[model samples]
Target: MSASAGVVVLGNTYDFFSRTRPRTVRRLAGRGQAKRARETAEKLLRDIIHAYDSVPSLTFRLLVVEDVATGGGGWTFTAENEYKVSCTLYAAAYYSTQVCVDDVLDQILNVGDRPGSLVPFNHTTTSLRGVVEAGQWVAAGQTLSWDTSQRGVEEPRPCIKRLSDPPIYRCVHEPEGVTVAAIRQETGTVLQITLNPLEYCRIGKGGAVFTK
Candidate 1:
């Protein structure tokens, strides 16, 4: 499927889950029981994923269900509960396929549900240069650049910012002086690197590093 079309499906999936979450939670909390809340949440998410997959044109897979805990809270809910859900969407490209729980939470209170309000996550394509020297190294200190002009393209640079966080860093087109973190030779001419928001640095040399 085309990337744009795939994104539309994803947004629709998120909206569907958001609108149904309240009902699912209520069913799980039948008679105000909290003891099985976590398990119930997990089952509900699995059921939702199955229901979504029945669309014939879409695929939904559960990745994780975490932080499912119950507690006493303010007026609205005497027994407050919190949980996080993560799922993977088989979209157009590998880079566009990862879906986190926060993406769904962002839509939880979206009253308008306007199409314009459903913004896809930020992503970019990156091009790396340099020769892989002895031992599959790309020469220490080599830099990489983000091709912001090619946003939404396949094989995008794996850079992401948390939706709720203050803008601490933003990837730019053609960022300069960005150092290499590490590199693994995927093929004779292609290389791959691991990216983790928490490990943006401290990863060693000859690797790709996304610049802010």
Candidate 2:
């Protein structure tokens, strides 16, 4: 049983319940509903403990927040080439949505800093904190991508693609006044989204990707 360095700085509804609810978890005594809250908090703590178990010793913080007053109407997402060689990708997209506190625990497993883009929330709190040994802390809402020069790549050439999907999903999306780029298909059964050098695509794969 190893110890967890991740600390839960704020428990959900702690301040709210403190002000509105008369009794604390310890004072709940035989109050059934309050007992349930205690159980839920314990479960959340366990989940948070596991989240920071492998985040490497770096300057990082997971700030969890949820409020009803404001949220993003839409979002922009991007990614870039992590390698040295320049490559041409066929397609790209940007998708994103608001982050919710109910899914914070699961975010580390799937979304991480991607969904941390929401604006400042007064009621929000830092639920977990850690220190990484090597890398600096990345800012919230910024995907890791490098700005690279496309000087060493082959010149853009005329290429064509033909699809043979008979009974399947078909889609086409492009905005007016914007020139469309290359169109490609997924590699085998695995989906392969390509990004150009110093480019990235941000998609809202946050809370929606988890089991509700």
**Which model scores highest in TM-score?**
1
- As a TM-score, model 1 comes out at 0.20
| Model 2 accuracy (lDDT, Cα) | 0.23
State every prediction's TM-score relative to the real structure: 0.20, 0.18
lDDT of 2 by residue, 34-107 (tens): 23433453344334323333323211211111101111111122121121111111222221112322232234
Off by over 4 Å in 1: 1-33, 70-212
Residue 73 of model 1, lDDT score: 20
For each candidate in the order shown, give its overall lDDT on alpha carbons: 0.25, 0.23
* Candidate 1 structure lDDT: 0.25
Q: How far is candidate 1 from the true structure (C-alpha RMSD, Å)?
A: 23.7
User: Per-residue lDDT for 39-69 in model 1, tens only?
Assistant: 3543543343233222222222112222221
> Which run of 10 residues does model 2 get worst, by summed lDDT?
184-193
TM-score of 2: 0.18
